[model samples]
Target chain A: MSAELKKALYNISALADLGQAITSESVFHEKIQSVFYVITGTFLANRGAILSYDKSADRLITVTQKGFPPADLDRVDPEKLMSLGKNEPFLIGDSPVLAIAGVKILAPLWVRDEFIGVLLLSGKLTGSPYTQEDLELLNVIAHQIAIALNNHSLFMDLSDKLEENRRLYEEMRHIYHGTLQAFAAAIDAKDAYTQNHSYRVAKYSTAIARELGWNEHDIEGMYVAGYLHDVGKLAISNDLLNKVTPFTPEERAEIRKHSTTSHNITSKIKFPWQNVQDMVWHHHERLDGCGYPEALAQESLSDGVRILSLADSFDAMTSQRPYRKKMDVQTAITELKKCLESQFDNKIMLVFCKVLEKEIKGELPEPDILPYLDRDSDLSVISSMLEAIIQELSAP
Target chain B: MKTVQFSVTSRLVGDAAVIYPKGYLNNLSGESLVKECGIYIGKGITKIVVNFSETDLINSIGISLLLQIIEDLKNIKGTICCTNMSKFLQDTFEMLGLIQYMVVFPVESDALQYLKVGKV
Candidate 1:
């Protein structure tokens, strides 16, 4: 094989190596700077700098440099470099080097479509005119370097997109949870008897959902829904809702409609819980088809809805209601256990019981207690979370 | 200048309210609709009739806020009856799964008639 052929093969290998390393390396800047080092070291050049055009400042900035004073080379403005024709090798005389170093060969690092920057390999120790071979090698190296840089840009963009998606998802989740929490708070505020009921239910439901091996989304929905399940009771006449005496049959009919009313309220929302409206609407439903409104019974409701039904019942049973004192946790669980197939799904009930046990043990902060019906409800949870928000909005 | 006129009217039946809103529900004019509905809540009105007979364009945020208001009303045991929605709005609402929580009516009178509890 000819010497030229061997050298060509070696440069190709170098380019491949550079591409692979740039693609995989997580330490971004170091990998980029290393590309210049690879070029300078591989080509046996005396010095080199990778000059990238700054679109913003409308100048060139030395992204990575070697064999030049790192600080001074860093300060050199790219805009000062005059426009060299596509194929024109940047001459030492026409170059900005006239003001700086007594240069020898300056080559434009042309990538596929455009000139990326110039590779300044100053005054060869050999004092030779750069051969066609040297320029070709530089061109190949430049191509690989550009590819690496573009890849880096894309990686940064993808990372940014992923980050943005994550942030928006979290914000939406927060908004959803906040809305439920607000609704819960409003419910508690109105009655004053069920101060901590919604909070307890949210915690218990979240734990139950997690125990059932539900994903974060389902767990979050259950937590939020549990908190706001009783929000419909708010529409119940405060007079009728808070009345200690037994309700008249007409009032009983009004009370029976709260679930559907609550469902109706949530139905307007466009979240993942398209079914939650149904679940909330049907939470009071019995397995015997004796439940109000739709009278949906066993196997008619989804497991999630059933789980919510069990959770709502458990919370209501254990809460200190105006009409009834809070039942003990054990009694609440037993009551739920007895209601299996009649109201709560047996399998879900078992899991819910375990979840309730976990809540009593204090494993996590009560998950999103207040149901925020809107942005306003969400803001009110953090004890002056809204204050900071109002302050920011009110700021000049 | 193109004009998009949207109007919402509220009628109270027992404890519920019926809101008759006409015109577009997109981000541009959703604020006015929200403000109008908010007035009902402020007046201790829970039940609502949202008549979307002539409404158009419900963006994601607008839909979100509308849902929020519904949820708010739920906490208070109030119902919002959406009536006279266009076929386009109805399809979008169904696809978005809003039918689960909200009841829809073909006409304003049907919703008022169904939602009303007094005298048949």
Candidate 2:
């Protein structure tokens, strides 16, 4: 076989190398470095560099290079290269701006009208001048390199935009949570006895939902429902809400209207989570059809509504109220356990017990309910009570 | 045919470094050969013998890396000896005119013997 044919075969294989490098699953830097190696190997040039055009910065940044002074490559102007023939290899002929030590060939890379970058190569290691075939081969390699660089530029732009969108979404979510807290504060402020009542319900409901294996989105919805469950109490008079005496039948009937009122208020706005309105509206309904407005019986209730109902009553029982003193932690647990089949779902009760047990035993990383309970209460006693309840509920 | 993964292992015999490069010399993995030689070059050892018995195939990327090693040795005014090259490897090197830059031997022991008796 002739030496020229061998050289030709070598150049063709070099093109194959370029294609493999460009399409490989390797990271961007490694791929570029591989391509640079292919170029240097094909031409047998001891030195070369691949510079990419950073249009935003209007500079030619060196992507990868060897055997050249980096400062000299940094000084090569993108504007001057843009005026050269697109993707065509040319001999550097004493041009003032193109002058660099040992550089014999320069290819200004382009895809369509967009100038991508330039490829610089020093003389061959063999001391042989580049024949017409070498220049042609370089042209083909230069085109492939241009497309790779352009695709990379497009990808980088997309990545930057995606990062910006992610940041914006996080900020908006933070603001949304802040606004919800402010609304809960206003609702709790309507009556003096219920300070942070809405906040506790939100945390407790979130914990229960998490324990039930609800996903983050649904847990977030449960939290929102807990915060807004008493939003309708905002419409009730402060005198009636803070009244110390037992309510007359008419007054009790008026108080029952708040859940329906909560449904009415929440139904007006669009929420991202499913069943927000239904959960807030049906929170006061019971499993046995004996409770207030709508009186949604078992099976008619959703897990979300059941979760909110249990979380609300537990917080209310443990907290100080206008007409009644706050129940201690043990009494509150007993009250919840006694009311389970009548007002709450049995499964939800079990999960609540298990979570509380976990909290008391120091098993949970963040004990949502324990932090809000009365600080003077004996955790050991509460933990024992929870263990018994959990056993009873866990029995097949 | 399955391509062998490229690897480079080196040992010092007297003042020279004998680098054994195994597998198909094709892609960026071949950079290991250059790095192996560079370690000796950095240590002020003037002689490098690359035994290519296991490297049966070579590509442009491989050629580029070989050029880097040759250039590195030239810059240090040192010697490079290539031993146990396959026929294809020898012909490719000869056609590219790279044979003029480095001494070649039929086997690794011959190169080691030559380096032992030759001037530093």
Best by DockQ: 2
Q: Can you write out model 2's per-residue Cα lDDT over A352-389, one digit (the tens) per residue?
A: 98898888888999889988999999989988888888
TM-score of chain A of each: 0.78, 0.96
lDDT tens string, model 1, A68-168? Answer: 77665556554444455433455575645434464455555445555455556665433446667766666666566666655555677799999999999
TM-score of each: 0.62, 0.96
* lDDT for each candidate structure: 0.63, 0.91
Per-chain TM-score of candidate 1, chain B: 0.80
Give DockQ per model, in order. Answer: 0.00, 0.82
lDDT of 2 by residue, B20-81 (tens): 99999887888889999998999999999999888888988899999999999999999999
What DockQ score does model 2 reach against the true complex?
A: 0.82
